[model samples]
Target: MTTPAVDADSQLLIHRCVDCRRWIHPETERCPECAGELKAEPVSGDATVFTFTVNHHAFHPAVPVPYVIAIVELAEQPDLRLVSNIVGCAPEEVTIGMPVRVLMEQRGDTLVPVFARA
Candidate 1:
């Protein structure tokens, strides 16, 4: 299948090592060993729910309670994961190792990547 296009302004979901050309994430100043400049760029934003937890209490009244939060592993870099909220499904429906994809969340002008079941 063809991959979707991404714009330049998006944060690098993972770090691509300048030396070894390997991908890493959560933003370090540079490659852990190489010390090369780290550049944040667009990623396909596809991932899988490696693991998750469900919360039944409301932290914010405006926000809904009984939500499932998870650490999703990006498809391109298995080790590159991000904490995201699982939506479009009930909290109890979440499961380990479930397939998910990216959904852009608007915060001011920024579009943060969130995940939902595929």
Candidate 2:
């Protein structure tokens, strides 16, 4: 018998501080609050664009010009937010409170979290 494959949605795990009820991003060594050991937990993929900026200037040659990067507030916790990009739409279209969902991008051996319009 073989174990079933886990979905891409399952791979976007984040840690939440039990004592302070704060969510911590991946690669964090210590909890920003309560100074407790953070544990991995599942999160809802739903979020709303909290704020964003349209960058038309590229410092790197590989990156395209005019892209929108945003900080989104998770539906589960309004205070818990993540930095993601708004894709599949024009940069001018991104606005605060725009609904978005998580998408994964291949970064070497890791799947980095990104977001697209919902």
Candidate 3:
């Protein structure tokens, strides 16, 4: 639905400062680096698992136990990272600094970004 994600549905939706070209995770009116205008942009789905936590406690019936919640650093920038889920594998298989690829899954009406082993 989101146009291949544009690159085979592997693109991650984010915002970038038009002036400084700095990627912003939470879009704002002005860029933090240069006060430039922010615009919605798509980035390469390439990323790495910066950190993760496996939840064994079930807080919701819809979500299964032992799911991986991770902070994934985007390949576009050194400090660029976002919170996402690791899928297509067991939670024990995920590790810090592990290479991952983004996938936009249909969650309700939104195509939420999730990561998988690359």
- Top TM-score hit: 3
For all predictions, the C-alpha RMSD in Å is 5.4, 6.5, 3.9
List residue ranges in candidate 1 displaced over 4 A.
1-12
lDDT of 3 by residue, 50-69 (tens): 99999899998988888999
TM-score of each: 0.80, 0.77, 0.89
lDDT string for model 1 (7-109, tens) is 5664435557767665656666688867777654567777888889988889888778888878888878658777878988988888888899888667567
Error of 3 at 99 (Å): 0.3
Residues 49-103, candidate 2, lDDT per residue (tens digit)?
Answer: 9999998989788778898888888787757787777888998888899999887
**Ranking of predictions according to TM-score:** 3, 1, 2
- Candidate 1: global Cα-lDDT? 0.72
Deviation (Å) of 117 in candidate 1: 1.0
Where does candidate 3 clash, by residue pair?
A: 3-6, 4-9
The most accurate candidate by lDDT is 3
Task: Select the stronger candidate by lDDT from 1 and 2.
Answer: 2
Between prediction 1 and prediction 3, the one with superior TM-score is 3
Q: Tell me how many residue pairs clash in candidate 2.
A: 0
Report model 3's TM-score to 2 decimal places.
0.89
The residue pairs in collision within model 2 are none
